[model samples]
Target: MDRGGLVVELGPGAGGTTRAILDALPPDGRLLSIELNPHLHRLVEAIPDRRLIAHRGSACELPAVLAAHGFAAADAVVSGIPFSTMPRAVGARTAAAIAECLAADGRFVAYQASARVAELCSPHLGTPRVDTELLNFPPMRVFRWERTGG
Candidate 1:
């Protein structure tokens, strides 16, 4: 992130990524984390940080969530949502919402166990750079895309 820019995180399962993002953010920066599961949302809300706004909602409502939080656009978005397991229509909507809410030149990064995310987001964000993290248990695919010119 760019010191004081805004970042949105999708599906912060247990708040591990939420804490990591908060640690990297500057005091003036903002992090809006959306977690659909109430149990996980509480875990994220427990993080004692002024810059963090943990909201319990579905990732498909990214644009609305950002707007409700008074965020015009996000500098970046990090996702841990299981795109491979979600219904195809839901995944498509979430991907479209992510693309619409990001700032020009903003980046979207998805950590997934499969390439389903890339398949779903390609139409909106273009092709993403794909990499595999061998260290993560069962390995994981990292897909990244950067929006240009809004």
Candidate 2:
């Protein structure tokens, strides 16, 4: 990420991806991670990066989360959420909040095991393009949804 830019992360179940994001972030950049499960939130908090903020909250609470953290929008967002396994309505609601939080040129990157997530996010995040990460256990599909408009 660009130096000093803001990036939001959702469902950081484990610290693996969180560590990767932190490593990639420029010293001045920040990553606000929202984890629905308190247990997982604490695990993410154990990551020692100065740029990371681990919050215990649902993705639906994104607006308030950002506001409380002094962020108006994000340069980029990442999610490890399993939208396909979640309630469609809840996924849509979370997607809407993410749409509102993204900067004009920002992208929402999701690691999905199914196509349902991309379909669910399309209305709020625009169509997503896919890439495969073959090295993963089940081979992950990475979907990227860019901000819908300029």
Candidate 3:
């Protein structure tokens, strides 16, 4: 993570990943956490971090969300959304928005129980490098993609 980078975290859920991101982020860095559930958004908002902006909204609104915060692009975008469970059209739009809003060479990392995210995002962001965590019950796949070319 860059010293003053901008990061967007989707589906922060209980905020476990949000806390980890804050711990690693430099004090000057900014974190935008977008969670669809109102209840989960409140939980993330309760995390007392000035650098954290907890937004309650859909990931499909990512570009607007960034603009609303005066962020032109993000250094990284990390997502925990259940892509496999979302409608294909919505997932495709969300993936495209993420690719469009990332800074050149920015990275996108998503942890999921299925490969559906890869199918939706690969066209816009290119192929991802996948890693599996066996420690997690039922296991989880981590898909990472880096922006390249134009």
Candidate 4:
């Protein structure tokens, strides 16, 4: 895949996936990571990467935050948020926000504990394709969504 567009990451707990994206993207590509936890933000920030910018905020504010950064859209939005831990209302709102931030052809990739796929999909803004990954701790399912229509 081309690595020339902006990438937004939601709920990157400690920058593990963030590191992977940074390594994959070109120098001209930009990565904006939103982390809700202050402690996690500090840990993510310690990693030296001019391409990575960690925002201390919630995923629900993704669209506005990306706009404030002069980005109207992103090529992809990857998430590692703990959807199972969120209340239904918040989860629904966050899901909406995620859909809003993506460009028409943009992709949203999220990783959730295996047991939470049904719960997570219940509030998703668009249809998602889920793939289970038993290699992860506690095992996980990767959900991918692509906005339909341009």
Which 10-residue window of candidate 2 scores lowest in summed lDDT?
118-127
Candidate 3 residue spans exceeding 4 A from truth: 148-150
Q: For residues 1-150, write the lDDT of model 4, one tens digit per residue.
A: 375788998888878888998989898888999999999999888889988888889988888899888898888989888777887677777877876777888888888874353455446545678898888777788888776666
lDDT of 3 by residue, 23-139 (tens): 999989999999999999999999999999999999999999999989999999999999999998999999999988999979999999999999999998888999999999989
What's the TM-score of every candidate structure? 0.96, 0.95, 0.97, 0.89
lDDT of 1 by residue, 40-81 (tens): 899999999999999999999988898898889999999999
State in Å the error of residue 49, model 1: 0.5
Candidate 3, pairs of clashing residues: none
TM-score of 3: 0.97
TM-score of 4: 0.89
Instruction: Evaluate model 4: give its lDDT.
Output: 0.81
Clashes of 3: 0
Off by over 4 Å in 4: 114-125, 148-150
Better by lDDT, candidate 4 or 3: 3
Q: Which stretches of candidate 1 lie over 4 Å from their true place?
A: none
lDDT of 2 by residue, 1-150 (tens): 656899899999977889899889999999999999888888999988888999999998898999999999988999998889989889888888988889998888999889888788788776789999999989999999876467
Q: Model 2, stretches more than 4 Å misplaced? A: 148-150
